[model samples]
Target: MVGHVVRKRLYILVFAALIGLTALTTGVAFIDLGKWNTLAALAIAVSKASLVVLFFMHLRWSSGLMRMVLLAAFVWFAILVALTLSDEFTRQWTPVPSSWQAQVQQQAR
Candidate 1:
């Protein structure tokens, strides 16, 4: 059937996208982006994942329910990242042990 043929082509496209993504990620790792390293990697990963979800997973032609499921997943992922970063950044304000402070003070003197 034509649908089957088209689906096969889509599969090949998805495979190519995945291979390109891998190469891009490898290239990115060699670049000294400093703080942007993670951002770059995540960007490429998200792009590659989007392609997979859209084409390979057939979400592009999926029903509203499927779209909602994908949206929910993304929302949950964002929440997790936000909560983790909030905890990590706030940890900087936590008190250090007295012994550690004493050692720092001794070093200063």
Candidate 2:
């Protein structure tokens, strides 16, 4: 009974922290961060998600196996994002074939 109350209090604290983080994120969005915008947004999002998982989901008190599962999920998501970004950023530097450009020019003529 008392444990449940403590858990609820902890959840309230986590919610407050999440709200603070959200405000910070919104504040940062108004500033000219240049290339840091994406990084800052991702950092705040991860922090908020961590708090939710730790308190709301009760992962903090869970067993090792559960923790590992959570870690694996994060790892997989990171890998997928990294691979996708790598493809996108790398393609920006590649040049289109002159043959294709010529075909488009001919079609427009």
Best by lDDT: 1
- lDDT by residue for model 2 (1-109), tens: 2332245677678889999999999999999899999999999998998888887877877789999998999899999999999999888576766778789899999
Poorly placed runs, candidate 1 (over 4 Å): 1-5, 93-109
TM-score per prediction, in order, is 0.76, 0.76
- Model 2 spans > 4 angstroms off: 1-5, 93-109
What TM-score does model 1 achieve against the real structure? 0.76
TM value for model 2: 0.76
**lDDT of candidate 2?**
0.86
Every candidate's lDDT:
0.87, 0.86
CA shift of 29, model 2, Å: 0.8
**Minimal lDDT window, size 10, model 1:** 1-10
Candidate 2, 60: how far from true, in Å? Answer: 0.1
Residue pairs in clash, model 1: none
